[model samples]
Target: MEQYKGRAIVQKIAAGRIWFYTKEEQSVKRYRVEDTEKEWKRYEAARDEAVRELNGLREKAVRELGEINAAIFEAHALMLEDRDYSDSVKNIIETQGVNAEYAVAATGDNFARMFSGMEDEYFRAKAADVQDISERVIGILSGRRKRKKMGKEPVIVVAEDLAPSETVQMDKSKVLGFVTRQGSSQSHTAILARTMNLPALIGVPVREEWDGKMAVLDGVNGLLYVDPDEETLENMRKLQKEEQERIRLLTEYKDQETVTKSGRRVRLCANVGSVSDVAGALQNGAEGIGLFRSEYLFLEADHCPTEEEQFQTYRLAVEMMAGKPVVIRTIDIGADKRAPYMEGEPFHLEQETNPAMGLRGIRLSLEKEELFKTQLRAILRAGAYGEVSILYPLITSVEEFKRAKALLKEVEEELADFGIPCGKVRQGVMIETPAAAVLSDLLAAEAEFFSIGTNDLSQYTMAVDRENPRTEEYFDSHHPALLRLIEYTVKNARAAGIPVGICGDLGSDESLTEFFVKVGVDELSVPPSRVLPLREKIRNID
Candidate 1:
């Protein structure tokens, strides 16, 4: 028996034979080509073919995984048409007088290297994207398909790494789980695995010889047992049964109120990125929509989503909640979450040395008045359909909060002037920074409610970039200082006679549930899947 430890992407258990995924190798051979025009034409043909394949995969991703995940392939398609990338391939082929495949391979390597060398974690992740697209085009040129076929039965797929496109193209039914030798938690493969609700592990030392061997993938413990002994298998089966029984028991609490043994009640909500996530929230008995991340509607688009587009999306979410209160945060773009279209025209976002602390959230909204007003109008209009609260992100001071509210009021007046029916929206502020937490009392006086964004609060309070892996050890979400901030924020909110909720990763931490309840947190909002488990935890607390 062999035991290996890895990082878990999704917490689940699966037992199956290992299947080593072998990608078709495209060995590009460099050769002198006399006909430069012919080579350029060949490259163009391959690019077109690759785009077609990407589009097909994108459609599949949309049908299985929603539009947000499908955006990965859309990006690959756009990368194929990027002028710098395509121009480099053309230049190498024409000037160097080399075959199209070799030129493409060379261009991919150079671009991937450049991206890999970038300091920003987001940009560094793009290096893998460049390689995926490059390999795709090269495969087309070489008349080979990059996607590998699975066997007849389900198996645990073992691979060095998987591109987003490759993962989406696989036969999902044939896949029991995934164990990769190399991948980060932020990798698209990890995201896809979570979306697919499949158990997955990364950073495992996978071996080709382990193929076809019985394996137990214990995602909860991040362990993989290859050809495990009888006793190990028995213990694993017992654990799996317990997990299944635990899940069954959780359903009993789904329809029950989230109240403690002492009869203390709290609102348990879900934070969703898109409208499609609302169904899951309802299934898991989310009392309301806590943090509706409105940025996704902008991020997934090639251009700025018009006021009507944003309105429809927001309206759909509100309506889906079926009269449940939905708190919609305004477009929180910039920093890691960037829209390419915003880089041009009137909404030009300048490059920043420290983007995380730069123009983002409410700052970007305030700087771009028209953009801000457009969203405010949509949220107000969506409010007519159902209960909707407009929450502004990154509120560092009272002045910023007042300025944002002033704009919202102006939009309401504009709607009234135009004789448009606009519903009243509850105003709220996101206490994400130390300044915001300290000034919560003043802001809460004017704001209807408060939502503590613990993710950024911890980051800014600790002066650590949460997304940067190097800062992982230092980035403490449960730091004493962060808890003090949350306690302070909640205390202020209570004094101001306004409810306060947490809408960050920390809200989902079951270990902190009792602490939050004890701190007088009015609500705990987390991902849809965590709602029931959190509710179960809340019920057990005194």
Candidate 2:
């Protein structure tokens, strides 16, 4: 038996036969159109057909997969209806006199090319979605078969890449796991696996010899075992049984505190993005809400959300927590994010070559004080309902922390003068940079609390973008240097007598639970689905 290593996106274990999948390539042929008006009509008709198909797929996906999976087709429907996409195709048809199929292909290629050239990997991955949507329209225009060839029995699908639309159409029951050569944690394929609770490995090496072979997809370690020996197979069975039992055992601790065997207690919280997720958190036994990402409010709106609108949302979260602490991270938008609502003239998101290091997080908030203050006032007012803490993201220095706090105080005093009811709220900063870890001593001295934003911390410290597929070979969360930075940040917070928590993706990892506990991490905030299991793991730790 030999192990093939890859980056694990969904860390679950599954043993199954391998099924290699390759999508049929669509041929793009340029042909002249005799009538531009007729071509335009054809394109419009195809687009309408595409939208209808997407809507049908959305309903089927909701019934079979779930709401989140169905949302993919919903997005596809929106893309098909987008004026920008339609305008591009219409212009090509009218100006160049190209046939509908050729016009669609050209416009799709241009859009995909734009996305492919983007610096952000998430945006880069979206090129496939654009192509997938165009292909569907083209297929409608040309009468091509577009259905996927799924297996009869469950199998682990190995592929080069799976587009969002393709992933939505997949048979959920037959897909045991996924091993893709081109994908990241943020990719749709990975997201689907995560939602389905399936093992998934991305950036897997291309291997043709292992097809139809029995293999163990060890997603926890990102290893693929091809035709394992008797002893190794037995060990894998034992481990799988233990994991199943652990999951079954975790249900008993649904309402219990996360106290270790030696009586060490830590607050277990859930990282939520929207109000809808709050119920899921409580259902999974989250003691509190650790990280409430506030960027969605901005992203979801055409303009800046009013203080009243933001207040209503924040209040809902605060009241839902019901006096339990809710650390709401202020808008962490950046140039790389390129939010749809913020794409217009008033919002000037710079196109930086290194968007990750450019204007983002606290920097953007400090610069766009008007937008930032709206959220501050809303959060402060929400605190009046229940326990609400403000968390500033990507704080790299003492000055940024102080400036943000000063702004918070300014808002508080402004509200006080107006006699607008606002409560005393705790303030904190996300330690997500190398400098932040090095200078945690200075920042923690002033902040009320700290949350280690491990995703950014890993990216900035290692100088590696986890979203980028090329960096998969070198992106190691278990790297000694990254762990030390986390340790250093935790140590400084502990010495300052302020609570510190890890609110990054790595915090949800089951293997690191003991390491975090030993380092005196005050809390572990993860996704709602992992809260119960993590609590169980914490309870099992000595």
Candidate 3:
């Protein structure tokens, strides 16, 4: 028996034979080209073909996964059209008089290295994206592009690493789980695994000899057992059966109300990143849309989205909810989620040593008044479609909250003056900072409701970087000080006659569900997949 440990992305158990995933390797070699223009034309043709392939993949992804996942391919397509990237490829081909394939390979390497060297984890993970697209174009140029194939029976896939495009193209039904030698939690592969609810592990050394061998993947304990002993195999099978039973039972709570044994009812909502997530949320039996992360609009684009674009997107989500309350948090940009255009134009966000604590969230919104007003107007316009509420993120002081509300009011009047129809939006504040939690009493009196962003609150309170693996031990979410802050915020909200909810990752913690319910938490918003499981926990609570 051999035991290995790796980080788990999805907490599940699977037992299957190992199937080593292998791809046709293409080695690009530099060769002198007689006609530089001809070589550039060949590269352009291959790039266009790659874009077409990506468009097809995007459509397929939308049918299988939701639009949120499909958006990855959209970004890849945009990358193909990027002027800087194309210029680099063209310049390399024309200057060096090299084959198109060699130029493309070099450009991809340079860009991937640049992204890998970034300090931000989010940007660092983009290295894989560059490699994926570059390899895709090269494959097209070399006539070596091929889709991965697996046998009919399910098996655990072992690989060095997986690109987002490759992961999406695989036969999902035949895949029991995945084990990779290299990947990050922020990688698209990890995100896809979590979305598909497949047991996945990264950073495990894989051997070619292990192919066709029986293995057990325990994602919950972050262990992979290859050629395990009989006793260990039996225990794994038993655990797998129990997990299946738990999932089967969770489905029974889909339509049931999220109420405690003592008859306390709490509104269970789903936090969504984009309009595409609304369908998944409803499918998971979410009663409302909570913490609609609106920043994705800015993150996914090269330029800031227009007011109409934002309005149409918000309107679709609101209409899809069919009158269920939709709490759309305004765009929270800056820091790790920066766009090139935001750094340059009307919103000049200078580079910061410590971006997380720097000008971001509500602070950035208030500083860029026109940008903030554009979003406010869209939210108000979308409100006319259904029940919509506005939630502000990273508000640290009463004055910040007041200034935001005042701006919103100005936009409302602007719309009314034009005789444009708009719906009333409930203004709320997210208690993400320690300062915000301490001043929740005063803010609650002015705001309509409160949502505690425990993710940032814990980070700020413990003075730890949640993204840093070195600080993982110190980034305690259940510390008494953090709990006290939450309790205090809830108490103040109650005093102000307003409802308080938790929308951060902590909201999905089963162990803390009881604590939240006992403390008069009015709502708990989490990912769509967590809604039913959380509802079951809430019902079992006394």
Candidate 4:
């Protein structure tokens, strides 16, 4: 085998192995397998092993990556534990009773034929994962595939599109990068790649059977090649080394305050949804939890959380911050995030072609007073434990703000009457809707603070349905019009003597940090991993 270099991205080195991908050509390939009974048993055993291994990974991911990442791991586990696929394979084996190899061969052949006729590329790729899994299982059962001792030399792996199991099964120590023909940004494989921090690229075509061949994977550009010239490889290696060096330098000051060259200082906080993320944020050097999503209290449960449950959760988050501010948004649920317990409320069963624009956020809370009241009571009860503030979502009108504030006041008074210790809770509004942005001055008069939720604000201002692919191009958060809305809201907040911050994808974007600062954003809350990098970027901003 000839040795060639691929653009290498060093993912986390764990368990003495590395995992990555190399780019390869996009061509249909055929694998012939014979149908047999022994093959079916082998497939079953392999499936069992994969399921067990994936479960262990899921548990680890929950502890390390937290609940959102844990959900991703669970999704992969379910895909492997697909009941329909397993049952179909079982029925075929029982009737045919063929040899193991033949059974494996027939299963692949049949599924390949069926999938080849499908229109959706995602479904078509499913056949490849199934075929690969069956082959790996059969090889292990038949004693054809052996565990090879991979050397220390790194290699960029190239493939059409790899299965989750295939990616996870490799000896990660030798894998330098990953390039695939297909993968969405949110695909399981892509998520794994990101979490692992491997420089990788997907959804690009590779050429020819180049396995064990000298190749180069340019992850940043999504390119791969075989037998590249020396100059090309050397340039890529230099770039890679420079990036690592810069990262090392950034690590030294990760936990320090980010101050500009002229000593203009700004606070960096984290936006988190669950308690599990609290430790990670603090460890990553976040000053505090800026936007604590309170929606998790209402999601993934049979019913609304009790006041004490929310209090405990909020208290834990506040205490973890160690005197840092925790701005918790009240339950921001609607048609898209419907809770099982709120099925009888208006818009509970309401269908919308564009749920993003439908009755949601503060509207749901406003229309359903009891539902809103329950969450208000919880936030109030939690306030005595630490410094906490309430953020209301989707406030398009002054009346919604009035009603929500009035209800919160009533809940606090009722709690006081019941001898429950409650303290002052500051209130704010999330300026996400276009209507809300237009009326920022009015809302700022009553709302104590303002937070521009650019995710929804961009969608509303652009009038683009984010979920619809046809309008995806129109969903630009950087559009001049959206920025004007942000400017409008920020200006209003400043004029009203209320603080404003940005807690969205826009905040984490290092390129936009200076722009956000220029716009007079007081605080920038982002994901934990981005805090340091953004701090580094902001420190240089004029």
Candidate 5:
């Protein structure tokens, strides 16, 4: 027995015997036969059986994991009925004169490859789902299947990977946790593990000969202790209890305000990307939308979003937020987040050798004034429904903010000319660059508010790309230099009588909660799930 390490998806702890699930594929004989109809019937029967099993799993998931998580099975059910997937299997069986098992196995690989080729990480993970469902059909057709009954006690599931379908279908009661060799923090397996509140570790090294081994899976620190000594087990028990107690304590602050011991109030808000996230954020007790990433609308579209398209999206968000202030960031493109449609002609950002430092954010908008104005018009129209404040991202200079503001004014004049009723929208700037932090006083004088984008500032100040894992050692957000920049920006923003906030991954870092509260930070905008935990941290700190 040996210890293994991996990335933790859900923070929890469990000690159980390993239960290895293996999918053994059968070699189906392929030949030219006139029995195409027979092969079709065989494929249909296997598909129907798979769907029936999936529906049963969906029901169990709803009972144990809740409806949102159970939807993964529903999607699997739909995929079985979807013509694109089903028809492809049928076509391959009929045309190639192969058995249902071989047809599905071949078709699944082809379809999964398509998703794996895509840029978006979300869609890339969906490829696993496609393959998982196909494997079910193959399993039935090849006369191989999972055990109909589970063991008496729950066991730790060790696998190469667990797709959404496989994850939802597993007997949750008999599965204490999961240990996988391949998966990311954002994989569907991770998401489901979080939903089920199960301890899970991914990216563990593959071990072909470790079945029935007793292992203490520590999800909090992402370590797996195989055949641990009594002392190790005792230590892990204490840590697990502490973690459970911490979670219980955090639940008490789900609806509490993030006021420091000094009685200074700090706004706890969520950085949402779309309207879909608004409901979850509110459920997690988000006071308001501190950063509405408006770039997703542009990034997801095939071309530039039309004024009405952008208007409706923004309006839905504002209306959903009700009276809460929603700081909508302007359409920030280029860099990692690129609008492929603007690759040529007026915007040749695709050719940038270093897009990370090239024309992006406010700089890109200033170059394409029309694109910036279209978004401004939509944001202003949305402002009519609620407290919608505009924030320009990647503002390194006062001149960039000034020019963007002028275009916004031009959009307002045009909207007014067209008999459109708009509300007064407060303009703000994102201090994401070292230069911006240095010029915060000048920017805050003109801007109504400031949201510090620590992700960018740390990268720029340290000249290390936070996205690159290789540079993670050097990409320290807690660097004294970075903190000083944040402290200075907060002071400058306060001097100009403007509210200052931090909107980045670091916003939820508990270690920095006291520091942020000390520096007179007005708000902290983090992911929806962090709203309550961060609030608890702030409320406990002065």
Candidate 6:
């Protein structure tokens, strides 16, 4: 066997496949192969256990109440209990499975065909899992034992893409870095790798022949060297040492307040979606969580999170932030983020051509008062722990603001009736749509604050779908119309005497910081990395 020694991160564990990246021809390549038999068997046992547990879950879901639909839960059960799936293995075992490995490989192919046409990506990926699981089951049936894929030599995992679940399975000690054939730095795999303090490089090219090789991965500078000469290897080691030192220097500054030389202090807050992300924000020296996208509480849970559950989540975030201002955006669910518990036919069945203007953001929240109320109560109850503010999203009309505020009032009254002292939770609206911007003056009068969601504002103002690659060119945040809308919202907020903040990707943009300052936004909240740079830029601005 040819051995190319280098660095790699373990991205996935399935069907004895160990994928890694190496730069052989001025490009990265994804290599994969069969892991040892023992590792394969261990994973197989785990799968069987999971399958059994999942089946039990399905049965219990029917007998008891679940957050998600019982029917949906049962579908997973049916998949596990599929006759065709189990029978394929049974048939293979009856014939001594030829080679048990070969028989399991055949079963994988069969399951893939059966699930290939399914619409869900999760289920489709499950087919691959089935293949892995079946391979293990067959191995167990045939009594094959082997070792795990951890090697003493360092390796850099390279793949076309790595899922979050796959990324978490990495053996950190053996993984030097990760280089992917296709991925953006903002993707989940990259983010997870960064959080884990591992080197990760994406957007590399790959091929099948790269299997069982070594490659030097430089995630800091996005460089990958495959099968390099002695000189190149030595140089890389030196560069790695320098990079580590630079990171160490940066770490010392992380805990310090992000103050500019000119004495302009901007709140460097983290934008988070989950409670687990609290540590990342604090580690990055976030003054507070500027935008806590609370959708995970609703979306991750099978059913709508109860008022108490929502309260606990907010409480945890508040505790984590140590009373820093946490701008909790109300459940930002929409046609794009459909909830089974919410009112609305299947989103796909009656999708609007103009979903941006359709049932989304605050519009959908109003339709589902129960869902909205549950979130509001949670925020209010949690307010006792720390500074929590409610940010309403996708508000298009003055009436919608009035109605939502009235509901808030109702919630406050209900809390009072129970002798619970609801904390002072300020209310605000996201200036996202064109209508919201145009009517910002009126909405600002009713709302406590304004946060310009530039992503949607740019889309609505420019009349461009950001998702469409063909029209991506027109989807600039710097478009004159978008700038004007931002100017308008900031102006309106100033007039209403309410604090206004920019919370979108544009907020952190150094190029736009000056313009946003000129437009007179009270605050600018960006990602953790941009905090210092943007602060520096603003400090330099006269």
- lDDT tens digits, residue span 1-542, model 1: 99999989788899999989876765789999999999999999999999998899799978965685567788889999999999999999889999999999899889877876788756655666777688888888887764445679999999987754356546677898999987665444665565455789987989888888999999999999999999988988898899889888899888999999999999999887677778888988999999888886776544466677688788889989999999999988877676434554335677888988999999999998977998999999999999999999998889998999899988999999998887888999999999999998899899999999887888899988754545656866679999999999999999999999998878877889999999999998887878888888899997
Superior candidate under lDDT, 1 versus 5 = 1
Listed per model in order, the count of residue pairs whose N, CA or C atoms clash below 3 Å is 0, 0, 0, 32, 0, 10
- Candidate 5 — which pairs collide? none
Model 3: per-residue lDDT, tens digit, 1-542?
Answer: 99999988789999989989876666888899999999899999999999998999889968965576567788889988899899999999888999989999899889877976888856655666677688889988887875445767899999987755456546667899999987655444665575456899988998878989999999989999999899998998888899888878888889999999989999999887667678889988999998887886666543456687688789889999999999999988766566544543445678899987999899889988877999999999999999999999999889898999999999999999999899999999999999999898899889999999887888899987654445655766689999999999999999999999999878988889999999999999987888999998889888
Model 6: per-residue lDDT, tens digit, 79-168?
A: 546777656644654454243345455676677656545787445435544544454444444444232345775555666665443454
In order, candidate lDDTs are 0.84, 0.81, 0.84, 0.66, 0.79, 0.64
Candidate 3's C-alpha lDDT? 0.84
Can you write out model 2's per-residue Cα lDDT over 101-188, one digit (the tens) per residue?
Answer: 8889888789978876888855654565677688889888887754445658898888887754455446666888899888777543
Which candidate order results from sorting by lDDT in descending order? 3, 1, 2, 5, 4, 6
Error of 1 at 407 (Å): 2.9
Tell me the spans in candidate 3 whose CA falls farther than 4 Å from its real position.
Answer: 7-10, 14-35, 47-216, 225-238, 297-306, 338-352, 417-420
Ranking of all candidate structures by their TM-score, best first:
1, 3, 2, 6, 5, 4
Pairwise TM-score winner, candidates 4 and 6 = 6
Deviating ranges (above 4 Å) for candidate 4: 1-247, 338-349
- Between prediction 3 and prediction 4, the one with superior lDDT is 3
Query: What TM-score does each of the candidates earn?
Result: 0.71, 0.65, 0.71, 0.60, 0.62, 0.63
Per-residue lDDT of candidate 5, residues 187-253 (tens digit): 4356446545689997788564667778899998999988888988998899988987886777778
lDDT score for candidate 1 against the true structure = 0.84
Q: How close is each model in CA RMSD to the real structure? A: 7.5, 7.8, 7.4, 11.3, 9.3, 10.8
